[model samples]
Target: MDIRIKEAVDLFQEVMFYGTERVIKSIDDPLWKEFSPEQIQMLKLVSREKRITSSRLAALQAVHKSAISSRIKKLLQKDVIRFVQTEQQDRREKLVELTDRGKEVLVQSDKVLTDYIENLLAQHVNDEEIDQFLTIFRKLKDIIKADGVS
Candidate 1:
């Protein structure tokens, strides 16, 4: 294997693990105290999709339907998400959407994360470097998407 490829992969893994850990830690405010990391992740995914079927959400999260079901149940109890009946003929398929409260939570969590990232970058990285990183990241994302990796 090429040394550059190995190094890049190592760095990517390190960044993913370390950045996720730090971001989780940074959101330790009272407003976030009630949520688990997994719950927050689910909420984030739901927010992005606007509405998603439980099965599709499980697939996206690479988990079994039962696991997603448990989380969905909890979120439902909290009124963070609501199930909407799908128009499919089966009639059993339900799609999950964020409630107004869920949207508020997501917004607040995003602000907290944004502030953390902005502070971290401001302290260590310049604007030009950030722009360059974004350009490269987007290009890499496009390449991966083109390859049907997701």
Candidate 2:
């Protein structure tokens, strides 16, 4: 590989690993004690989509529908998410939505992560640099989406 491409790949890997580790550590609070990391991730996805079918979520997560169903069952037992029947003619379609408690957990988690990221950025980067990074990141995201990488 070209030297520049190799360097970029290495930097990307390092940044992803370090940033994820720091964010996970920062959010290791009592607020999340009752939830596993996978469960929290599911909640975050549901929070974003508002309501999504288990099959769609399974596709997004690259897991089997059975796995998604099991996770949904657990979330249901915890009273964090509930199944809502869609009004489609099929009538068998169900979507998962966050309960009040799920929303509260997601909000608190976002606040914690946001605070951590803001403080980290404040310590290492200025406004212009942040804007530049965001622009580049979004462009990359768009390119990946366009390429059907996910």
Candidate 3:
């Protein structure tokens, strides 16, 4: 293995440890206590996409439809999201959209994530390093995708 790759992996592990801790703290904060990290991600996607099917969402998150549906049910119960019958020609297809409350939660979560990333980038890292990190990560993604993991 390349020494640089090993060093990068070490850096990633350290950042993940601290970053996840901070984000979990934010999650546990009262304003966000009701939502899980995955739920917030789904909510944000729904808020922007306007509406999406569980099948599409599951594909996006690389999860099974049943698992996505389970989370969707919780979101519905919390009034975080709503199911809409697409007023289209397809009568059997249903869509999920974020409720107003869901959007609000997503916005809050975005702020937390943004602040966390910003802080992490600003301290002990520069723009060049950040760009390199994203490039390397994207390359890794391409390699994995080429392996037909999805």
Which model scores highest in lDDT?
A: 1
Worst 10 residues of 1 by lDDT: 25-34
TM-score of 3: 0.68
Q: How far is candidate 3 from the true structure (C-alpha RMSD, Å)?
A: 4.3
lDDT of each: 0.88, 0.86, 0.82
TM-score: the better of candidates 1 and 3: 1
The 10-residue segment with the lowest total lDDT in model 2 = 24-33
lDDT of prediction 2? 0.86
Which residue pairs in candidate 3 collide?
A: none
Regions of model 2 farther than 4 Å from truth: 1-10, 144-150
Q: Return the lDDT, model 3, position 27.
A: 44
Instruction: Give model 2's clash tally.
Output: 0
Give the per-residue Cα lDDT of candidate 2 at 81: 98
Report the C-alpha lDDT of model 3 over 9-47, residue by residue, as the tens digit.
898899777867777775445556777767877887787
Error of 2 at 72 (Å): 1.3
On TM-score, the stronger of 1 and 2 is: 1
What lDDT is obtained when candidate 1 is compared to the true structure?
0.88
Number of clashing pairs per prediction, in order: 0, 0, 0
Sorting all predicted structures by lDDT, with the top scorer first, yields 1, 2, 3
Winner on lDDT between 1 and 3 is: 1
